[model samples]
Target: MNPEKAFKYDVLINAEDLCDREFEQQDFLKRAKAKKRTIVFAPRRYGKTSLIKNVVGNSFFNLSRNHLVLFFDLMDVQSMESIAKRLHHGITQALSRRFPVKTLLKNATDYLKGFSLQMDMDPVTGQPSLSMNVKGREVENEMTHLMAAIKTLSQKYPTLIILDEFHDITFVPEAEALFRGVLQELGESAVFILGSKRHLLTLMFQDARAPLFQYGDEIHLNPIALEDWLDYFRERMTPNKIIIGEEELKWILETLCDVPNAICEFGAWLLDNIPSGMTLSVGVIKQSLDLMVENKQSYAYMLQGYTEKELDLMTVIAKNKFTLEPHAESFLKLIRVSKSTVGKIVKKFMDRGLIEYELEKGYRLSDPLMGHYLATR
Candidate 1:
């Protein structure tokens, strides 16, 4: 493979080349084949999306080549209409993948009756785009119809529906109940894979009072193992004569917090900027890391979005790495905030995906690079 295309940092990793996740892939496939619902919980940049794509692309549950896979990104969803529109488009795109435009229109005409579906040529790509419009008071009805269409399609084909960033559904009132109703209705006709950040996703499924409590098997994604990273690094770099030792590779993983995307970014950076001899020394590696941190300066504006106390509390957490006790007297003194204030700030940042809590590590910045940047800057 071309070195330029070998490291995929900004996009989904190719199915064949995706590293690690062997256990996850097999577990997910087994559940999917058995038509079990799954909730995937992970921090951002942990390759949740790539993992799902790989499973579907490679296995397809050993089903027909035309099995349908629908992906809906529910990020920042604010209203019922937004949910309805996303579902409508996701169903349409999934069908398009299986059938030609004419067949899609002909078949969907019956499957999607009563919904105003349109097929138009995209101005930018000149490709056909299919969409459904949800109007005024009919938003709820449209959402119901969309879910029904999913059930109908699943009965005829092996189907997988993925809702990415599903935690954003909380923005819409009673959305959880709405989804629970749909899940109860669907049964084994389809497999639903819901992905979201760890903390919020856990609460949604584990809190008994929540509507989606115990709805599916929950899988929490952790960092890729160091041995797997070593193998992947050697395979990708050795081909291009890029010389990086195992120790240096392990340091890169630790420095980047074992986030697959960031590690790939580092690899891509090395490929683009390594010396002509293709040797990566400690000084060069450190310089590369420094440059990566410097490039994150744009994220400094996020600090401005918080209040003074929030910023101070974040700084304390970032610098200290993790705080076992945010309300402890010494920790509170460092941030110069009351326990109540710290509690509110921690919750706010956690919700915003800036902070995360580990059972052993307590509270820390969700993105370690952001922590490093905050500590230095």
Candidate 2:
């Protein structure tokens, strides 16, 4: 076993720490400053959270010190009421950070009259905490008030509200209709930043029959270039007196499909678990791969929720590196299921956010690590 080192590479990095997402960051800032409604998307664990946190939350475009940025993560939201509460809380949190407590309370109460706002002392910390409440029909009314408040703030501060995992909004019944109606009424004063799973976001924003169709400009966040990641890896490794050759860097990128988070995580493992002042070699790489296989057990556990047929279908997917047409004779013989049954299985996996399909790429596993693990296993 290699002796552990103290140095750690964070999987979640700030924009300054981020490697080569300049174009995506600039596009986002440009659309936001112009008050254009925009939707940004990428596959899960592709650093959507990191980008928004560092770029928007850090206010890269706030040159005048006049824009208020409110960020909300809808990943945990399951209902309209929860959305209202989160929005109300997110706005309050942003205000509390920028202004005095007394001023925050007064402004919140005045603008968000639909929600009762007050300041209370924390029992344990003896710190002042803002409390807000909206019940029953007031939830809807307050959601509208919240948008209006944001619009009002935008006139002075040019507010930008980023709702991460915005596609989750579709899970709540009639939530899309309510949001569309409210945003249309609210106008362009406040810019909306929506980040979500690419496929679901496309269905929500690009599908003609969807309520929010054509409502926002769409941008895709691509994986970082291998050259940029190579520099990042070498920079991180050299400071620890550890060296990684070009071939090793290329192997890591290819194995991880150039996804930023996975690469950083494995790199963190190499930095922290390997002995300090020791150069990384192919043996160390093998050890890392072994550790990765151990992590794949978690993916295996996830597979427990699936049926045997589904498991076999996943095997077929992994073996092929892409899903073959269900009706194709070779595919049908391999899965030993009817074409309609295979179609249903594929749809179910897609709905569960486990698969993606493209004409050029065919069907792909959403988690590249999972696909790699399953393929080798």
Candidate 3:
């Protein structure tokens, strides 16, 4: 294997580059085929985006050839107008990928009547790029039109609309109710997949009072099994003549809490820093982890946003690993906060993805690397 083609770690893993999620890929595709609306919940950096892209990418399920897969990320969307623009762009981009520029413009004109469409060539990829723009103060009406257009287009082409980080939609007033209404109107004409962080997504879909409650089948993406990771590492490393034993692999996985992105970062670090035919050692692993922590120095600044009490509580949680008894006398003494205050701060931390709770493990820092950083600092 070429050195350039060795183990790669990217923000977005390509379909073919995915490690192991065969079961999830199949399950997601199954739901899409049934036209069932689905909601996926996962921790940050747990490969939720990668799984969705891999399932829909041409090299995998090949849904793009026959189905119009419109993917939009609602992350940090502040207004209804911004959402309208994102929807328009996603629709046009998905159409362009499926149909030729000329045909897409001609066929989509009726469906996208209100929006101005422009065709441009991407300088880097030399591919046709479509841009959609609409101007108006009536953002809500524009959203309604977009949904109506989606319903009409779905009749011709089987459609799959993915809204990633969809919890951010809460920022815009009445966005959830609007979406629920549109979803009801579309019925089985389209399949929708909504993805978000576990904490926020759960509140949106599980709260009885929420408009989107029980709106879709829910799926949670868990960490890849250690056995699978070991096999994947061995296969990838053997080709490059790099040696890593199972014990060292397990240690790395445990250190990163089996987060796929973090593990891939470690692998990429090894491929770049270590020489071929050299066995991975504990010392080298420690260095890689330290380097990773150093690379994530920006994470520390996130602390500035919290209150002093919140910071103290977080520090306690990080140092202890997982606290089963957060309200215990000793825990409360450490944070110097009342029991009620501890509850509020813990809820806030959980809401922000700073901490997670397991039935057996209690509360722990969501990012284990952050735990190491907090411990040392």
**Among all candidates shown, the one with the greatest TM-score:** 1
lDDT value, candidate 3, whole model: 0.75
Error of 3 at 319 (Å): 2.3
lDDT of 1: 0.75
Tens-digit lDDT track of model 3 for 78-111? 8888888778877877788788888877877777
What TM-score does prediction 2 earn?
A: 0.85
* Clash count per candidate: 0, 0, 0
Each candidate structure's TM-score, on Cα atoms with residue i matched to residue i, is 0.90, 0.85, 0.87
Model 1 per-residue lDDT tens digits across residues 1-377: 45433778768775666788889887877776777888887767788888885565347634776677777778778899888777876787776666777877777767775666678898998888777654435777888778778777777777776788888887699787887777776675445555545678877888998777887877788888888887887777777788888788878887666778878878877777775457777777978777777787566776778777887888888788778899899998897878997888788787777787776767878777777777767
Q: After superposition, how far is residue 151 of candidate 2 from its true place, in Å?
A: 4.1
Candidate 2 local accuracy as lDDT?
0.71
Off by over 4 Å in 1: 1-5, 134-137, 278-284
Q: Residue 24 in model 3: shift from native, Å?
A: 1.7
Q: Which stretches of candidate 3 lie over 4 Å from their true place?
A: 1-5, 57-65, 123-126, 189-192, 239-241, 281-284, 301-307, 324-328, 358-360
**Model 2 over residues 313-357: C-alpha lDDT tens digits?**
887786676664756888889879998998888877766667766
lDDT of 2 at 124: 95
